[model samples]
Target: MDLINTCFEMCDYIEQNGVVRLAGNVKLRDNLKKELLHFLIYISMTDGRYGEEEKAFIKKKLGFDVSASMAADIKNRNMLGAGYITRVPETFKYFILANAGHKIKNDRYDNKEARTLAETYRKLGQEYLAANTGSTEVEINVLSSYCVMLDENLKSYGLLRPDYKSVAIQAETADEKEPDADELIAELNSLTGLTAVKEDVNALINLLKVQKMREQMGMKQTSVNKHLVFMGNPGTGKTTVARLLARIYKAIGAISKGHLVEVDRSGLVCGYIGQTASKTAEVIESALGGVLFIDEAYTLTNGKGQGDFGQEAVDTLLKGMEDHRDDLVVIVAGYTELMEEFLDSNPGLRSRFNKFINFEDYTAEEEVEILINNCKKQEYMLSRDALEEARRFFTERVANKPEGYANARDVRNYLEKAISNQASRIVGLKDVDKNILAMLEKEDLVGIEL
Candidate 1:
């Protein structure tokens, strides 16, 4: 895989903050290489399958095939992380995480075994896959899981990411290219709808700027809670706005790094008793210097009562918020009524999150603008008739909008369906017409049900 080649390139030749040096050149005396191989095997079998794609990849790099017993051991054992990698030294810790920390099903993480330099990539991969799935949702993304682990490790090791092309530094890529406060605010204001949300964000930004200036002038300022509550339905750009806010905080030096770590109750509350606190703490640690955007935070306090362990997570989260008050901002979002109930359920939650911003549903015209924007992003165009049809479709849909309608998300689904319809119609054509391929006709939109 190309990733493996990049890792090799990094091993043979690399530069760290202007100093060029060869990494992984130090000799090792542990069973790190074999442990690393086993960790790779565990990640490859994550989805309950280890096909030829995985088998061949492992064999080529490790110089041996994964035996049947090894595969079974991976499946039978809880995971390969806790017992293998977290206890290693910084040299191997950095090496493992940089090379094998992240994985996607379609993407491959390949690297040669360089014993002289270091042979401990599996540690990162193992730490990532070490989340106790026994008590969490099955759909929790492996990539996100591993990424959170990698971030915690990076913070502990005091390391900075070199490049996005390098797997070891995946956490810092977003920050490296992040826009400043003005640019982020401009982007937020440029969204199709959410006029009220825009005004609210602007007012908050102004307040912070004045507060900073007052501090410079030796004027004592009251404590301001950076945490907020977002009241809106799904897909109303809550997460998007929260992400922009993170960068804005960083650009203004309110936070150390401006990364947004998004998670819901599923990412926080563990099924086990004492485990929930640690799990919640780990998630908070990853979000130390950024915003933690918790969607559907209402679920955590939905009358599940003390037995649910959701309360434990909430307690841990509150402690983390206070402990890292200077650097972390927490944004909890849900439907208007449910969010009210969530806040009502806890006194501390109500006190800490006094600022509330409501994201209104998009109007029909705004939905059409969103459609056009989506098309323009992918180099697709809607014919005049198609655009008019989209307008009518959204107008009627908005007039009779159902409960829990996902605003821009609905537009995205319609555009994707239109593309699929266009492909189906053009597939039988004898010649490939660039114009036909690029344009969405009226019938394409007409055929879409939503």
Candidate 2:
């Protein structure tokens, strides 16, 4: 049967079985039916050639034979101005899947072909929506999945481009809908410390924006390499800054998805020789269209000798960074000296990460501010004396023993200790009120060594 007739039969089945509540307006139902036919035609002609396999599959599943002339006419009419399908009804999607399943039933339901057809229909539905809305505003992660599926299924058969640009249009549209440049800048400025780090990130974001603008204006533009190296002490907000940078990159269309996937050497390197590369690749695969953040990244190179699997992980990671350069951002972070040595260890690493952002340890005042923020979040108010004690403690701790100070992390630990002390001190207070419960006094902050 032809696609239109198959759609009609499916609609009838849906109505008869009460599979979906039909719209009260007869015209609305009719329009949806027409849209379904348009969608099938579009998918059939997407690659510019409707083959015998597709026709035979349709006939076997829909239970009617369709001629080549009829398929060609549908393709031509759709090209002329049949209009694209915007929103596909859930019932119709299920129906298409069910039909595809039926066609493969005699073949023991080849799982691979079923998955390919299912994903093809899924992408077709999304592409139709993107075309109808004149905006490619679909989620980039979803679009990336579609592209992966297309590469696996259609690229092998010469039915789709290996670059997957047709599927990527949806992500580019979503990138266009990113938050405004000024808003993202404002967010960067709103951070508590990391003054130098903020400036570097802002400059990178501005450079990306200009490059994107130039591309839009038909001017020559250079590709911006986004992989970065972060050198800083623990608890100095390297991870926090990396997250914000991911969002900024996405906002400027430098990346598709802005999510941050944080990992360390343990997550990528395996104990076995060949396992490390596969493990690293799996991690990178999950981080496509997003940022892959390797914290304490220097540890990946700590293993000695050529027998170490860490090098295998690094090689795999470098290749992934190169392969997915357009959609992926990699940030390696660790202590200043250690990260430098790690980068020096791998000749390929230094060139790929041209941008470096140094996160400075927070000042005593900044540490106090962090503590205050933590206290506020936990519904605990520091008394004036307690606040003074905290400031004095941090001042002495930072000045006297500055070498291994954990910055904001130390502050958090201090606050947690004080809260514990407060609970211990109040355990005997049966008559405690809200005021006492919410307050952290001087005694609570005293004698807590950094």
Candidate 3:
């Protein structure tokens, strides 16, 4: 049986044997039971369909079978609506632990099942602590079992044990040192290629710095919108540049935080009405003190007509940009032409995003440099002939580029294939030395088409 089925069986045993009883008031007990049932049903439905086994298990455990209509209502109410459980309250948490403990006893303390149960318990406990602040000392004691279980499970899984004391010391030794504006600019300049893009970013940084200085010197200053549009092809480093822009803004005091929250069309757009706004707002809230990087942003408007919720996502995003203009920088990225069409689709978008940075595709030489960097990162070396072959391969690949040609991403894939070929070549050799093991031969690059 799967984990959820096992949990249901344990719950059934507990209910029939009266091994654990709820100690709360009648209403609280009923609510906790309802929530617990909802959680089980939600978890079971995670695989996309509720089965006969699940229904039978629920009927046997809870003493009542739900009709098809009732089951649909439960799914729509809990999974589709606001009744989906994200946090475990104290009462529901106890119910889970009670059933888990009974399962452990019934299984005669089997280590494997115990370890799996421990992980589930720890996840739920961590969720509770994340959602609540003023937990009582007794409640803390209960949750502390989660950490104990985690440690035990690590050992059970034969993973390298963590050093908590050293971790705590290292965390305490950390300092909140912020990078200066020049430092961030230098970092941006150090990236390979993108000369024009770097120039535009540097100019914007200078403009922001001058504005800040003007404010300090008692001069009139205008409000500047920091929203941006990054137009580029796939693997052209749009996301990477967006990340650096976040740090640049933070260093120049334009934004409060330097973190980057990246999302695509699916992250913001939802299936139902009234949910797209909440979903988009939630993502924006997480990115409040940082940057929200929306990649392939043109896809947000790819829907057929008004039936699509993509427009709702765009409207919510525009509102977020206006409301959090000071601390949040939203960078929408996509292919150059599609991004332009997307901007023109909504006047509000074009008005808010005044700065446009175009990321050009990498040259064949730049692509070779990126491949070499990847090799160095993986501690692999290419023979002289192999290196020449790689350069020729990249030149040809870019010359005969396909529709979805990912510049850097394609290079990485080529390197990965070469590495795999090298592995297949060397895996059977018994007399291989360190140099032989680390080197990629020209033969490794012979059969790669792209």
lDDT assessment of candidate 1? 0.66
Worst 10 contiguous positions by lDDT, candidate 3 = 160-169
Off by over 4 Å in 2: 1-181, 402-404
- Candidate 3: where is the Cα deviation over 4 Å? 1-178, 304-306
Note each model's CA RMSD in angstroms. 22.0, 18.5, 23.4
What pairs collide in candidate 2? 1-64, 1-65
Query: Per-model C-alpha lDDT, please?
Result: 0.66, 0.65, 0.66
- Give the distance in Å from residue 444's predicted Cα in candidate 2 to where it truly belongs: 0.7
Model 3, 1-450: lDDT tens per residue? Answer: 544345445444444455455455234335444654554455444444555655665565445576646667887865532333334344434444543444345443232333334334433333332222232333333334323323332332332122111221232333944655544444455455676677667546655654565566575555667888999899988887787788778877898877889999989988998999999999999998889999999998866386988889999999988888788989999999999888887889889988898999899998887777678767788899999998888888788887778999887888889989999999999999989988999999887965
Residue pairs with clashing backbones, model 1: 4-110, 24-117, 25-117, 96-121, 98-168
Clashes of each: 5, 2, 0
Which structure is stronger by lDDT: 2 or 3? 3
Cα deviation of 31, candidate 2, in Å: 58
Q: Top TM-score: which candidate number?
A: 1
Per-residue lDDT for 105 in model 1?
25
